[model samples]
Target: MHSLETVILLLVFVLGLALLAQRIHLVFPILLTVGGLVIGFIPGLPRVVLDPSVVLLVFLPPILYSAAWYTNWSDFRQYVEPVIVLALGLVLVTSLGVALLAHSIIPGFTVSMGLLLGAIISPSDAVAATTIMKTQSVPRKIVTILEGESLVNDASALVLLQLALTSVTTGAFSLENALLEFVILSVGGIGTGLALGFISFCIHKHAKLEPALETVLTFVTAYLAYLVAEHLHLSGVLSVVTAGLFIGHKQSRVHSPIVRMQAVAVWDFVIVLLNGLIFILIGLQLPHVVNAIRGQSADYLCVYGIGISLAVVVIRFVYIFMADTVSNQIRSLIHRAPIFPSRRYTTLLAYISMRGIVSLAAVLSIPEKLPNGSPFPGRNLILFITFCVILFTLVVQGILLPLVIRALAFGQPSTDYLSRHEVQKQLSQRALRQVQRLIDQDKLTGIAVQAVIAQHQMRVRELANAETAPLLDQHQLNQKLMLTSIQAQRDELINLRDRQQIDIELFHEMENELDRQEIQWHPVSG
Candidate 1:
């Protein structure tokens, strides 16, 4: 089949599997991956080769940007300590542990090759963990830490991977040099990202571009941050992440409402497409990787795969416990209060160590040949093992995460709804007072004054009732009834269009107006 035809078919497969996943209440990534695997094994199907550069250059920047963009900056800052432990310390530990295991298990594997494999699988995928957490009421702090870890760990892992690859090519290793390089790259990447973000902000401030162009510029900023950092031999992953965080934080202040809304919609659509395609591509690589290492015994492959996967998982679990203990000890020494995450949160964190597409991309990007013109040592094996780890964790751990959360009941009962309600009530009361003050100051007595005061008073009353009732308040009840009525009107509008009683343009205009109304009323909590 033609390449375009193959892509179209794969997109169809993505949609179909996504729908199936929704129907079955399974995480879509797992099902999409399995679907891709099945499709890959079909007889005479076109081989869809995954280009590593395409992944690193094209898909990664936007995906990472979107994740960083949506992250709650305040929560991330508050959980910075644990995020560092997981993103940096735990990743290094996992890499070293996996390095030892890979070196011992694979006959010809070097320490550098082992480390390369280790780094490839070190960072857990944020999307997989967060997607599962969204379905459950996981604690806000846990979610923030996980997101922060996922954002920062990619840079650490990728940097280590680069160092390992260099060591393999040179047949030399130096810890002091590697550490120095790591610091330099990290600092440089961060600086570049911030600088680019500031520049983008300036452009938005001065240019006054249309919403569509502004949305386009946000994507441009992401790609530019990655490309510029990579060109300068810095950590492009960190650069993209940093730029995203900076831009995301400033967006509310710098961007107009229409731009923000449009950018969000565009980014959401793109991220979904990219995420689905990425997991499917990861699955589709299975056959090719298996073929690359075909001569190995089935039992041998199984042992290697299982052993490595187990090593990564167990290493993380142990590290989380060790790190938390050590953290508490240090806090005690410094006379600071301990037990922020608690034991339960630590256990949940350990369970969320599922690897995903970044691992696959890192492993697949291994050089086909070394400087000596020899094929890179253990390249095929590394790819195969990475796939196994991702599959094992994603299927086994991802499936069990929600059940574990329910069993533990670790999520806190959030007060965000009540807080929003309180704020709304206060605002409405303030507005009413302001209107009365303005009317008295101007010595005005007319229909306009009565209209403004009445609107504000009504809002305050409704909000006050909502607070008192807490659940199913008069405001909420009215919201539901209003929505039901709107739905009936929507049905009638469609029927009118079907009967040719309304022109297409008029129908579309009315549809958009209804959409705006729905958006306005949907947030009935406040």
Candidate 2:
């Protein structure tokens, strides 16, 4: 088979495996990674050469952007303090501690090399952490912290990694310069993102186009922001993240429903593909990473890898535990929120410090030759250790994560039916209020007002009935009728707008009202 064909076939197999795993209630990311490792070891398969820079340039931006966009901005704002501590402070502490341990334990390793390794593995892959955590039912606050930490820490870790790499190459380092660069990169990236996002939003607002075209624009915007920022030597990752968050938060207010839904679907697919490809690429690099170690004895490298892995794991645990303690105290004093840190949750959080694609990418990013002309010291060794850490994280930690959750009793009881009913009740109340206001204003009259009011009341009663009985039949019937009518109105509006039968301003006004009505009728939270 042609190499491209072979790659396509492999992707199909992986997708199939993912779907099968879904049926069995298993997480797909872990399965995809394992499948990739197995496929990577097969002989005659084309070697997937993944440059570290390419990984960041191509994959990191979209993934980070999508993550930040979907993140609950309100929750993020509320927990800014803890998020900052975990994202910035914990990363710095872990990097320094790992550097110290690596220098002390590994023979012939320089401080620069140790620090480089430290920076490479310091920030946990938000992709991996979030994917694993999604399967278990955790507290909202805890989940928010994890999500917020993952989103911010990448920028910190990447900045630190670049600084360390530059220091290694130049044979000198300055803390002040590093700090200045961090500030410049962060601020510049955010500025670029906002500028680009606003421009895109304006274009979207004015353009008369299909939903698919708008969706395409969103995809292009993420990469464009990254490329533009990097061309100017700014933080591309941060820029892309900022743009995504801005677009995601505001698109609902600006775009049509069709455009918004289309954009969401497109971004969702892109994120899934990128994440799957990243993990698989990590697995494919295993052999090359092992081959990078030319002079070191296999046994010695294994021993070194083992030691560094232990240090990475232990240091992360200590860092998280300490940060959590400090965060709890601050939260209590400032907000008076209850401090309930489950030991089991903390332990799981500690084990979740798995280094994957990002670590491997950074390790591979080491310059082949230093300024003095000697090849970079222990580059291969660093790669080897990074792979070991990935394995330890994905295999050991992934396998045991569920067991830990079960043992800790961390999964909340399923909230399915009650939650759904509560959401329906809320929606019914909102609809009733809307109808009453329309009647009071003399906008709705006679049969039309009575029909809407009766329907709203029936919905309220059905939701109430759900608390006592399943009410599945009644709920299903109401949902069907409501959705059919919504579709009919949407179709009628589209026809009228296309024919220019309604003035543009009036069309938009009615469409916005319809959108609000649709949202009230079908709340997504539950």
Candidate 3:
């Protein structure tokens, strides 16, 4: 099939699977992966080989940026310590454990080679985990830590993979140099991200670009962060993530509401499409991986795959429990409460070790051949094993995570809803006071002023008694009536435009005003 045709087909496939996934209450990533496998094995279909470099360059930035963009900065700051432990410390430990397992299991496999493989699959994917978690009633802290770890962990794993690759391919290694390089890459990437994020913020604040242009710049900023960091031989993943974090935090203050809304919608769709395509592409790699390692027996590869997959899960479980214990002990010594994560929370955290795009991209990016013109040892096997790990985690754990959460019944009512309600109430009271002062000063006048005061008073009362069922229902009905009135105005405006009673410019201005009002009434839908 031609390139365009192939892309169209993939999109259709993704859309179909997404719908099916929704109907069946399954995680889309798992379904997409399985769908890709089914279609990949279909006879006479085109064999697709993804360019590893393209995957890193094109997909990584936007995906990382989007994840960072949505992450709650306050929550991330609160959980910074554990996020660091998981992103840096746990990643290294998991890599080492997988390395040991691979070295022991595979004949002629060196520790460095094993480390290379381990690093490729060490970082758990946020896309899959967050998507699943959003559908369930998960604790807010778990969500933040997982998101923060995902943002940082890829950089650490990539650094380790690079070092291991260097050691394996060149037959030379230096621990001190490697450590120094990791620091430089991480720090430099973060610096690059901050610099770019500031630049983007200034552009949005000062330039006052229109919504479309501002949205476009977000994509450009993401790519620029990654590309610049990579060009500097730093951690591109870290750069993208940092840029995302800074931009996400500042955009609300700098960018207009239209820009924020448009960007959110665009980013959400693009991320979903990218994620779906990625998983499907992962499944499609099976045929090529198998063909590449034709010499290895099926049974042999299966054993390696199963063993390595099991090792990855076991290592995470062991590390998380141990870390929890140590952290709780220190907190107790300092007279702080033990943070009170029961075994259930810890188990959920451990089970959230699903690997996705980054791991597959890293493994695939491994050199096809060494400098000496020999085939890269176990390249195919490593790819196969990585594929197995991705498949197993996404399919098995993804399916079970929801069930587990349901069973565990994390009963923490979301504090976010209550906080928002309180804030709304406070804002309404302030508005009412301001309106009263304006009337007293004669700065505002007429029936409109009284109407505005009445609206504000009603809002304050409703929010204050938000827990009362009758008042809540009244608020909902008020919103519906307001929306209906807005719709009627919109219809009249459209009718005037159609009958040429109003010029196009006036029509558009009126339409935009209506849109602004609609957003106030139904912010999420708008």
RMSD of each: 9.6, 7.9, 8.8
Model 1 TM-score, all chains together? 0.85
TM-scores for candidates 1 onward, in order = 0.85, 0.81, 0.86
lDDT of 2 by residue, 148-267 (tens): 887888778887887888888887888898899888888898899899999888978788667678777887888999899888888887888889878876665567666665566777
Q: Between candidates 2 and 3, name the one with more favorable TM-score.
A: 3
Q: Distance from true position, residue 75, model 1, in Å? A: 1.0
Task: Supply the TM-score for candidate 3.
Answer: 0.86
- Screening candidate 2 with a backbone cut-off below 3 angstroms (N, C-alpha, C), the clashing residue pairs are none
Model 2 TM-score, 2 decimals:
0.81
Clashes of each: 0, 0, 0
Q: After superposition, how far is residue 188 of candidate 2 from its true place, in Å?
A: 2.0
Tens-place lDDT per residue, model 3, 1-526, is 8988878888888999999999998877788777867877877767677765577777778988988886656567767888898999989998889889999988877888898999999999876787888778987668767888988898789878878988899888788998999899889999999999999889988886777999999999999999999899988888989999898866645665467668878988998888777767766767877988866788989999999999899888999899989989999899887654587778888888899888877886887789899989888888888988988888898888888899888886343322434433443465456556656776655555555556666766777888531222224434544454455555555444334344333444445555666667677541
Off by over 4 Å in 1: 411-418, 426-449, 467-526
Of the pair 1 and 3, which is ahead by lDDT?
3
lDDT of 1 by residue, 153-210 (tens): 9888988888988998899999999999999889999999999999998998778898
